[model samples]
Target: MAPHHPEDVGMTAAEQPRQGGKGPRRAVAARDRTRQPTEVRRRLIVDAAVPLIAERGYKSVGVRDVAAAAGVSVGTVTYHFDSVQEVLSEAMVLHIEQYYAALSEAAEHATSGAEALRLLVDALFTEDTDRHWRMWFDFWHAGEQSTDETFARGQADRYTAWHRQIRALAERGVADGEFSGDDLDGFTARFAALADGLALQRLRQAPPLTTQQARHHLNRLIERELVPRSPA
Candidate 1:
C-alpha cells in the first residue's frame, strides 16, 4: 500500500465551480486553505526528521525520506526549507533553544551556584537515555561536511553561546563565594568540556553509567576544584 500524506487524510480536492463567474472565489478559498496547512506540515516534518537523523545519521537521510516520514510530499518539505541543510540547521537551533530555555528557568529558581549546577546536571541526565547527546553527535557529524556558510556560522554561534553561559555561571559562583576566584575562563572551559566528554562517552559505550554516578562525580569535581576555602 502507498504511504499516506496529511492532505490525503481529510482534505478534499477543491471542486470546480458550476459557473464560470464563481471560479475565482473558489480558487481564492483553496489557496488560503493550502497556505494554512504549510506551517503545520513544516513542524511535522522537523519533528519526524529528528528521530530519523538521530537513528540513521544526518548524512544518510535525504529530503525524500524526510517527506515520506513526515507524510508530506517532497515539494512540501522544500517549500518550508530550501534544502536538507536548512532543515537540519533549523532543527539544531530549535533543540538548543529548548534545552537552554529549561536551563535558564532552572537557574532563575536555583538558590545557589551548587543548586544551579545540580539542576543543570539533573536536566542533562534526566532525559530519555541521552537522546539529546545522540542528536547532538548527529548534528556535529553533519556540520563537519556541510559547505553552507550559514550552517557553519550557526554552529559556531551555538557553541559560543553555550560557552558564554558557562562562563557567566562560573563568575556567579565566584561572586557568591561558592567557587574560588581562580581563572574563571579555565573553570568554565573545563566544566563545559567535561559535560561534552561524558556525553560522548555515554553515546559510544554500552552499559551506560547511571545518572547518579555522573552527578556524584561531577559534584565532587566541582567541590574540589571550584569551591573556595574559608578565610583564616
Candidate 2:
C-alpha cells in the first residue's frame, strides 16, 4: 500500500469511493500513471513524508529526504511544497484524513451498531496501525513545545472532531436500539478515552497487548457496556 493509503480494514480499495462520489469509478487521469497531475504528484510526496516523519520526528526530515523517499528530485519537492515543514504538516493532515476516511467508509456499510463498532476496533488495532498511533504520539509531544497557536489549535481540533465522531456513532447505536443507553455523551467520552489509552499503552508500555488481544478487549467493552435493548 502507498504510505497515505488507508488500510483496507473492512472494505477494499475498489469498494472505497473518492470524496463526495456515490461509488468508486474509474478515473481517466488515473489511467495514465506515468503522467500524474500536479495534485496527484503533490499527494505522492505528502504520502511519502508521512511514515518517515511518523518514524523520525518532523525536525529530522529535510526536503532532500522527502524527495529521495518520493522518488523525486529536491527541486520537485520544493516546487510542490514551500518548505520541509509544509511538507510534514501536509503529510500529517493527509494521514489523519486517510484515517477518518477509512472509518467513515466502514461505518457507511456497517449492518448494525455492533458491526460498526467492531469494524472501528479492527481498523484501530491492526499491526500496520501501530505506526499511526506512534505518529500521533510524536505529534502530540511536539505540540507541547509549539508556540504556533494555529498549529496547536489545528491539532486540538482534530481531537475534538474525533470525539464528535464517536459521539455521533454512539447516538446511532442508541437510535437503532442496538445499544441501551441514553447517556450517549458519557458513552462517547468513555469509549473514546478507552481507545486512546489503549493505543498509548500498546505503543509505549512493556508487554503490549497484541492486536487480537486489543480487539477482543474493545469488543468486550462494547458488548458489556452497550447492552442490546430487547424488542417490545
Candidate 3:
C-alpha cells in the first residue's frame, strides 16, 4: 500500500474522488493493473509522487522515482500519466486540496465566524501546515520557471480558490455582525498575501522560525485586523 499523503489530514479515505466510471480517459492500463479503477489507480500513483516531491524537490523527481515509490512498474506510471509534468501537476493539486480540507475541518465546529477565522489562522501556521507550504512554494516556483500557460492557469486557479476561502470567512463574519469591513476585496488580498509571506519564511528557515513563532505572529495580525476598532 502507498503511504497516506497529506490528504489524510482532512479528507477521510472515503471522501477522496473515486471514479473509474467517469472522467476523461487515461492511457490504457496493463492487464494486471486493470482491477484498480483508473481514477483510483491514478490517485495511487499521484499520492506516491507527493512525498517524493516533498523530499526530492519538483525538478528532481522523475517517472522512475514515482514508479519505485508507488511500487509499480515504470511502464505502469507512464501508462497512467501522459508525461512527467502531468503527474507532477496532479500531485500538486492533490496536495494543495489537502490544505483546504484541513482548513475547513478546523473551522467546522467553531461557534462564531470570528472563532472560525482564528481557527483558520492557527491552522495556517502549524508545523503540519508547514509541510504543505513547502509543496506550495515548489509548485509556484515551477509555475514561474515554466512558460506552460496551462500550468500557469492551474496555479492561478488554486490561488483564486484560496482567496475565495479567505473572503468567504470574512463575509461570514460580516454577515453575522462579528466583523465590519469596508472593503472585503482589499482585505482578502492583503490577508492572503500575508499568509503567503509567512509561509515562505517558514519554509526558508533563514532566521530559524519555529512553528510557535509563526502562529503567534499570524494570530496577532488576525486579531488586529479582524476586530473592528471603536470610534473615538
Candidate 4:
C-alpha cells in the first residue's frame, strides 16, 4: 500500500501533528468526562448530608454516615470534603443558595406585593413538616458553635437577601396603591420575625399546625398590611 499523508488519513489542518508531538488531545477530554462522575458523587454526598445534618445536627453526624446516606464509599466522601465540618459548611451554603433561588423565582412570578409576601412566607414555612422542621432545628444547633466563616457568611447573605426582597415587595405595594405602611423597615422586620416565630412554633408543637392554619394566619397578617382596603 502507498504511504498515507496526514491529510489523506482524514486529518484536518488543525489536527496535523507537530514535530515530536504527543497523542491526540481528545484523550485528555475523555479523561475529564470520566472524572465527572466523581464530582457528581461528591455533590450527592453533600446533598445527602444536608438533610442528615439538618435532622441529626452536624456534630452527631459522621463522615461514614454521610457516605452511607449518599450510597458512596467513605473514601469518596473524604475525597470531596476533608471533614464533617467542611461538609456541613458546604452543605449550608448549598442549602441557602437553593432556598433563596426558590424565593427569587417565586417573587419573579408573583403578580403583586401581597402575592410575593405570600410566596415568601410559604417558602419559609412550607416543608415536609416533621422532617423539614427537624432538619432546620438540627442546623440551628450545629451553627451555634460553628466558627466557619463560609457558614456565617452564607447565613448573613441569606438574611440580607430576604430583607431586600421584603423591602422591595413593600415598596411595590406602595407604588401599586396596595400598602400604606409608614415604615418599610419596621414592617419588613416584623414580617420576618412573625414568620420565624411561626416556624419555630410549628416545629416545637406536637401535631404541628396544619398547612391551612399556617397559611391562614400568614395570609391574614399579610392582607391586613399589604392589601388595599375598601373605602367606607
Candidate 5:
C-alpha cells in the first residue's frame, strides 16, 4: 500500500513513544507543526542537522537529536526523512552548498580574478574553516566506506564542480591578462589536487602543515602560473 503521507513510513521504536496518542510530546508536536509547510519544515530539520553533524559527526547525530536541535518533534524528523542516513545526506548537501557560497562570496568581492583567486585561497585556509574542513572530511570518509556506487559518483560529481569553479576563476584571470592560459586544464587539476592533499596533511597533524603554510603554497602556485609579471 502507498504511504498516506511523507510521515507514513514505519516508525522505529525510538519514534513510537513520542507519537503515542495524546501527551506532551504530541501536544508539542501539534504546536510545532501548526500550518508549517512540508518543504519549509523539512528544511528546518536539515539545517538543524548540519551543525550537529559538524560538531558531533555523522555517527553521533540521531533523529531525536535533530528534533531537539530544530525545536521540533522526533516524529517531525522521521516525517521529513525515512532514515538518519537520509537526514545526514540532506544536511551534508546543505553544508556543501553553504561552503561553496562562502567561497563564491569571497571571490566575487575582489576587483580582479587574480585577487579573487587570492581571496579564495585565503578564505579556504583559515582557522575558522577547520570545522568546515572536518565536515567535508567526514563526508568523504563516508563516501569512501559506502559500497553504493552513487556514493563515489556523487563525490566525483562534487569534485568536478569544484574543479570547474577553480577553472572559472582562472579563466577570469586569463581574460584580465593576469594569467596564462597555456595549461589551464593542467593548472586546474593540480591546484584542486594540491588543495585536497594539503588539507589532509594539515588534518593528519603528524608533520604539521600549518594553515599559513598551506596558504603560502597555494599563493605560490598562483604567482608562478597566473601572475602577469614577477610575483611582488
Candidate 6:
C-alpha cells in the first residue's frame, strides 16, 4: 500500500493553515487514534464503576450496573474484574489517589503552612468535593455490609495514606511555627477527624454548609492549635 499522510486524511500541510494549533481537528485526530486496549478498558471500567457506586451504594451496583454504565457487556466487565467488588475496590483506590493529587496540587501553591492548611480545608468543604465524599460514604457502607477482604485492605491503605499526608502538612506548619502541639500525632488526628466530620456535614446538610462558613470554622480550630514561636 502507498504511504498515507495528513494529506490523505483530507488535511494537507498547505491546504490547512499550518498554524500549529491544538484545535478541534488535532483533538479529534488524537481521539481517533487507537488507545492502549488494556488501559482504555480498565479506565472505562473504573470510570463507570465510580459514579454508579457513588450514586448507588457499591453493594447495590452490580456487574450489570457497571457494564451498563460503561456501555459494555457483563462479560467485558468480568474480563477486567473477577466481580463487581473487585472493580469497586479498584475504583476506591483510584478515587483516593486522584483526590489526594488534587489537594496536593492546591497545596503546592501555598507559601506557608497556614496557607497550606487553608487551601486543604477549603478544598474539602466545597461543592466540588461532594461527589468524592459521597463515594467514600458509599464505599464504607458497602465494606461494612460485605466485609470483603480486598475492600478492607484497600480502605485501610487509603486511610493510612490520607492521615500520613495530613500529618505531613501539620508537621510543615509546626516547622513554620504556624502550628504548635507537643503531640503532633494527636494534633493531626483531631484535625483529620474534624475535617472528615465537617466534609460529611457539608455534603449532607440541607442548604449545605457554605464553603466560607466551613473555612472560617476550620480557621478558628487551627488558630487554637497554633503555638507562637520564633521563626526557625
lDDT per residue (tens digit) for residues 147-193 in model 6? 67766777888888888877777788888777665776776788878
Q: What is the RMSD of candidate 4?
A: 11.1
- The segments of candidate 3 whose C-alpha lies over 4 angstroms from its true place after superposition are 1-34, 229-232
RMSD of 6: 10.0
Residue range 72-157, candidate 2, lDDT tens digits: 66777877777787788778878887888889789879987667878888998888998888887777776788787877887988
Tens digit per residue, CA lDDT, model 1, 95-167: 7778788787887698887678777777777547478788787788778988888888988998888888777
Off by more than 4 A, model 4? 1-33, 37-41, 127-130, 206-208, 227-232
Best by TM-score: 5
Clashing pairs in 5: none
Which runs of model 1 end up more than 4 angstroms from their true locations? 1-32, 37-44, 127-129, 206-208, 229-232
Best by lDDT: 5
- Write down the lDDT that model 4 would get: 0.69
Against the hidden reference, what TM-scores do the models get? 0.77, 0.74, 0.80, 0.71, 0.81, 0.77
Q: Tell me the whole-model lDDT of each prediction, alpha carbons only.
A: 0.72, 0.77, 0.79, 0.69, 0.80, 0.74
| Least well predicted 10-residue stretch by lDDT in candidate 3 | 4-13
Clashes by residue pair, model 6: none
TM-score (C-alpha, index-matched) for candidate 3? 0.80
Error of 3 at 34 (Å): 5.7
Error of 1 at 22 (Å): 23
Q: How many backbone clashes does candidate 6 have?
A: 0
Residue 175 in candidate 5, Cα distance off native in Å: 1.0
Q: Which residue pairs collide, candidate 3?
A: none
Cα lDDT of model 5 by residue, 1-232, tens digit: 4543543223334444544455432223444335567788889889889999888987788888988888766776777777877888778888888899889988888899889998999988888888888888898888878786756787787888899899999999888877766788888999988888888888788689899999999988877766574344
**Candidate with more favorable, higher lDDT: 3 or 5:** 5
